[model samples]
Target: MNDGPGGPGDQAAYDVVVVGAGVVGTAIARELAHHDLRIAVLDAAADVGDGTSKANTAILHTGFDATPGTLESRLVRRGYDLLEGYAAATGIPVEPLGALLVAWDDEQLAALPKLKAKAEANGYDRTRVIGADEVYRREPRLGPGALGALHVPGESIICPWTTTLAFATEAVRAGVDLRLSTRVGEVVAGDGDRPHEIRTSRGVVRARYVVNAAGLWSDELDRRFGHRGFTVTPRRGELIVFDKLARPL
Candidate 1:
């Protein structure tokens, strides 16, 4: 809690409690600070970005491949613009390197036009179906039997580490109570006209509202509060990493 004027409460009762300190979690906390509310962001790790947020493919989604008019599409598009600007301002490493949907067969080569249409449907007009000659010219290191591809030039790579850290740090600097290694195991709702009591290893936390952002284990927290509408279904996307010099064959 910041001692600055109009800061969050310095007492035990927080106006809002947010679990998890990942990129998404910290962003929520940061946005909530614009309002007159006491927000506490908690993380189980020793520090923020120690979770899955620190890993995975560092590619920034252009919302080009995303389904049109979907929630993820809108957020990813807005988030792309938001992060691109934020990354520039905060010195977060980001390279807007274009990607080629490499094709090695006739079927995939035929997919280029359809994929281009899909990109147009998603509000991305820059995507185009390039010829095999242009494809090879763009990615000279591509493997043999390669055909044409759908070029999405907006895709970029970003530093996921700095992105999460930046959000968490900014939110902390903006008057958020960031608690590290503090895990809430149980939540006992107070009776009518009383604050909710959350039991953690350190002590009990009494808060007016609570948000569960605990990536994989968010559902468990929701169960304690007798709220069943929310369920956490983990979705895993696995990919193989490669250095710039490593070419597929």
Candidate 2:
């Protein structure tokens, strides 16, 4: 991993340059390294997974609730199996504790079957709709009148930090240049076979192809290349830590 700034004489271009060192960025870099390509990963943070990747809920979703026929649904379903196997082989901590989509009202109760059907459409057929009695039976610490719940048995929790670190470590071992604390500024288009010049805080990085995995700032980066297909709106979520004594619940 080359975490230092590039010198003036460092003019060698890369085949692919990933814009972030988060989980998605590192994963892309690691995958690209298998193709014998010259890859580089750049991040504004001092270390890998220092952004939203470390602050997520760390759930390995089954795509059970994802909208059917979407690219996200397909990728999530495929990624779940891939990540599960990778975690097993790489010693990444994972707990297959599953999840429950609880329904507290009659309207929500009526939607459980639809949700189950949606899960089935997304190629996940393990979801079962259990009544309130079964819900309380599985979770005895219930405190209200729950109608029913969609028991998604494929949902699992994982250690996001270890996962991202593993990808970055593997990519670095595979000769992918990792540049930390390098913030990309402007992107200059290249003509013909010339490499695209990416101006960063430290120096200019030339690459044949550039990938944007900047998370919240992805839209801003896309506009640099004259793309306006989508916009990113940041949403705040709260993470509550419970004592280990409440693990049973």
Task: Estimate, for each residue in 114-199, the C-alpha lDDT of model 1 and write its tens digit.
Answer: 88888888878999888889988887877778777888899999999988988988888888888877788788887667888887
**Per-residue lDDT over 1-249 for candidate 2, one digit per residue giving the tens place of the 0 to 100 score:** 343456652464888999999999999999998997989998989999999999888999999989999999999999999999999999999999988899999999999999999999999999999999999988889888988999999899999999999999999999999888889899886766788899888788898889999999999888886789689999887889889898887
TM-score of 1: 0.88
Error of 2 at 64 (Å): 0.8
TM-score of each: 0.88, 0.93
lDDT score of residue 130 within candidate 1: 84
Best by TM-score: 2
Index of the highest-lDDT prediction:
2
Off by over 4 Å in 1: 1-11, 190-192, 235-238, 243-249
Residue range with the least summed lDDT across 10 consecutive positions in model 2: 1-10
| Candidate 2 TM-score over all chains jointly | 0.93
